[model samples]
Target: MTPDEARTLLEQSLRVVVPDADLTGLGGETDIRERFELDSLDFVEIVERLSQGAGFRIEEDEDLRTIDAIVGLLSRGTPHPV
Candidate 1:
């Protein structure tokens, strides 16, 4: 998937997790956990949703702190160890 597509999917997943989250003016590099006040479970749910939506398995150790990082991972199709 393209970055734009991945970003859209991420946004959708975020909405599913935090319906009232204010995503406006959210930067690519912004910390999602900080911005949305997501706890560990919420974060995990979002990651699972993203993985299911993107048709890929995101490992637990992946650097998914920022939207940019998640989008990059999704756009790459499949993840490999760095």
Candidate 2:
């Protein structure tokens, strides 16, 4: 999928994990972890959801060490490493 498509999926995934969050104003550069106050478990869940939504094994491809990294990975259509 394209970066835009991946971004949409990421947004949906974020919403799934944090429905009350105001994601409408977020952009590709938004720091999800800090901005949403996500913990390690929440980060894991978000990655899993993003993987499922994108039809890829994200956790096995790249390290999602930061929200910027996550966005970069998604934008490049790359998966997060396990």
Candidate 3:
């Protein structure tokens, strides 16, 4: 997937967890957890949703702190299982 595609998927997943979040001005380097006030469970849900949308598994060990990180992971193609 491309960066744009990954970003879109992330937005959709985030919306499921935070319906009122204003993502229009979100920066790529912004910390998602802090920005969205996501608890551990919410973050996990977003990861799962993103994986499903991308048709691949996103390992828990991967660095997913920022939108840029997650987008990079998604656009890199299927990640090898650890």
Could you report the Cα RMSD, in angstroms, for every candidate shown? 2.8, 3.3, 1.9
User: lDDT per residue, candidate 1, 1-82, as tens digits?
Assistant: 8889999999999999999988889898999999999999999999899888888788868999998999999998775322
Task: Write the residue-wise lDDT of candidate 2 on 1-82 in tens digits.
Answer: 6666776777788888889988776754676788899898888898888777766667534666554566667666644443
The residue pairs in collision within model 1 are none
Q: Which order, best to worst by lDDT?
A: 3, 1, 2
The alpha-carbon deviation from the true structure for residue 37 of candidate 1, after best TM-score superposition, in angstroms, is 0.8
Candidate 3, run of 10 with poorest lDDT: 73-82
Sorted on TM-score, highest at the top, how do the candidates line up? 3, 1, 2
The most accurate candidate by lDDT is: 3
Go through the candidates in order and give the clash count of each: 0, 5, 0
Residue-level lDDT tens digits of model 3 in 9-81: 9999988899999999888899999998899999999989988898888887889999999999999867554
lDDT of each: 0.89, 0.72, 0.90
Model 2 worst lDDT window (10 residues): 73-82
